[model samples]
Target: MYLRKMLFILLTFVSAVSLAACSDDENTTAATPTAKANVKVVHASQDAPGVDLLVDNTVAGTNLTFPNNTGYLQVNAGTRNVKVNVSGTSTTVIQANLNLMENKFYSVFAVNQASAIEPLVLEDNLTNPASGKAHVRFIHLSPNAPTVNITLTDGTIVFGNVAFKGSVDFTPLDAGTYNLQVRDAATNSTVVLEHS
Candidate 1:
């Protein structure tokens, strides 16, 4: 009788050990890593080696490049301030924050040098497509200029005042060489015409 009792206890102990080992194997797990983010820029004219980069008013990097006028830059998942300069002139400055996702691609392009902070002379229609109804747009780029008024080659009045970073659209009244006059809204005295 004692022998049989001893045998039963040993069997129970073996079964408990086997169950414990199986439970541990099921609980084991693996981990996955986070992804990366990317950003790109495209323009009619590219930024040269002297361009500067900033993040939240902090200089992050500079002197960007791309052979095809497409510059590529990488940043962590967060917001940044993008700054560009040409030679000695800071042609333009822009502030933007991008929410980047892990392992994702992004593009931030500043095709026009005119930022909202500056005054500029805007001649909206450059291509001058003969389609009378073709649309053209102009925007001011001077920091202290306003309003856009100009006399066409024919001495016709168009656009009065445009604030800095403001825009004007022109639907060519007639298909002909129209001299564009654009001035800031504040100082109507300063106006420029794009002569074709």
Candidate 2:
């Protein structure tokens, strides 16, 4: 009889522990329904002045200049209002509503001339590349520059004729040092060069 009682107590303890663990797991799952999203603001307009970025009317980034970006801003996943204003002025340069998904990444591009600025939102590809490979992407932000080809010093064209405010998809290459050059597509004149 004593042995049976002890067995009953052990079974009850096991059941209680199991129930507690299950309840805790359920609570954890419920608390994590949505994840945060990351957004980057890029200033691509060649002549536009530095600007301030706002999220829900709050200043998220300030003094973002041409051909640059505010690396990444973490925000809750939902519909959001994004606004860009010229620095130290009330002049609103760009305003738009963005629906951001959980755990996603985005880039907001402010492009065109200062008088006629435009906004472009692009979803970033966040997929991981294969092992032993490096991934690279390019954004063409120069307003006056013509369509350009990104080439290696060896004369191999990696990306061709990317227009102003355009971008090239990420391409994977083996790890190595490279000399890259950007040339005007029409005239083949080198505009930018870098070694990496």
Candidate 3:
């Protein structure tokens, strides 16, 4: 009887151990690492020379011209000190703090004249548009240009009354050739015309 009781206790203990091990496996899963953020620099100041983008005092881009963009820089998620400087010069044009979140997209714009340069942080929504559509966003970096209207060459208004240094969200357009025009809103004077 003593030997039988001892064997029964041993079997119960083994069963408990087996169940605990299975429970541990059911509770655990493979952990995924945190995603990184993406940043892009744009030179929007027309009067400023080619500029450099600095993050944490490190050069990220060099010699970017007006309306040019630095595709995307992958960075760890955190706060970053961003600076814009004239290319190859120590003269810092602007300084700002960028709070970067994981798996997000950002555009840093260097706008206005050199003496009073500014940074515009634009958070971009990277959602894919519907089929046969294109995503287009507009920025008004022309400092002296008046509030303008964007239209097709056929006078179809696209963006109405966009002021200097202002911008608009991305709108989906059909895939096709576009003759774009930027005209002064108040006087209807043509400011820019492009065939694309």
Candidate 4:
């Protein structure tokens, strides 16, 4: 009879503990939804002056010079107006209406010479590469540059037939230092640029 009573008490305790666990789970709140996107801006216009980048009329970057970039910044996702104005001035040089979606990444580049500067928007894929690999991408921002191939110094082509303003998608490469060069597509022998 004593054993029966002890078994009954143990069963009751187990039941109460299970119920409390379930109750705690039911009271827990879920994470709130986010309505934001990440944006980065690059100044690729060789002849353009230092500039300010504005999103929805609010300055996001000030005095961004040629070849400089404003790294990823989070902003409200929706129809947003982006503008570039000469630094310390009210004169707007480039503007665009960007329809950004939530949870995505975007890059905006100011390209071409100062006289004809324009914005180039690109969706960015930031997925991680495989283990022991790295991601690389190429963008041809030189306005007058020709179709070209990117190659290793040993002459293996990594990217081919990219023209002016063209961009190569992110590709995985084994992580290591590489000596690379840009060669004309037509002959694949004339070196345009070289980097180590």
Worst 10 residues of 3 by lDDT: 5-14
- Model 4, residue 148: what's the lDDT? 75
TM-score of 2: 0.77
> Which one wins on lDDT?
4
Rank candidates by lDDT, best first: 4, 2, 3, 1
Give the per-residue lDDT of model 3 (tens digit) for 1-196: 1111100000000111233333354666769876789998877776679988888999998988876889889977789898888899988889898899998989887777767889888887766766777667777776666788888887889878888667778777775678788778888777677554
Q: What is the Å distance of residue 139 in model 3 from its true position? A: 0.9
The better candidate by TM-score, 1 or 4, is 4
Q: Is candidate 3 or 4 superior in TM-score?
A: 4
After superposing candidate 4 on the true structure, give the runs of residues whose Cα lies further than 4 Å from its correct spot: 1-34
Position 129, candidate 3: lDDT:
66
Question: Judged by TM-score, which candidate is best?
Answer: 4
Candidate 1 local distance difference test against the native: 0.41
lDDT of candidate model 3 versus the reference: 0.74
lDDT of 4 by residue, 24-94 (tens): 54677879976999999988887789999899999999999977789888989999999999999999999
Candidate 4, 28: how far from true, in Å? 10
- TM values, all candidates: 0.37, 0.77, 0.78, 0.81
On a 0 to 1 TM-score scale, where does candidate 1 land against the true structure?
0.37
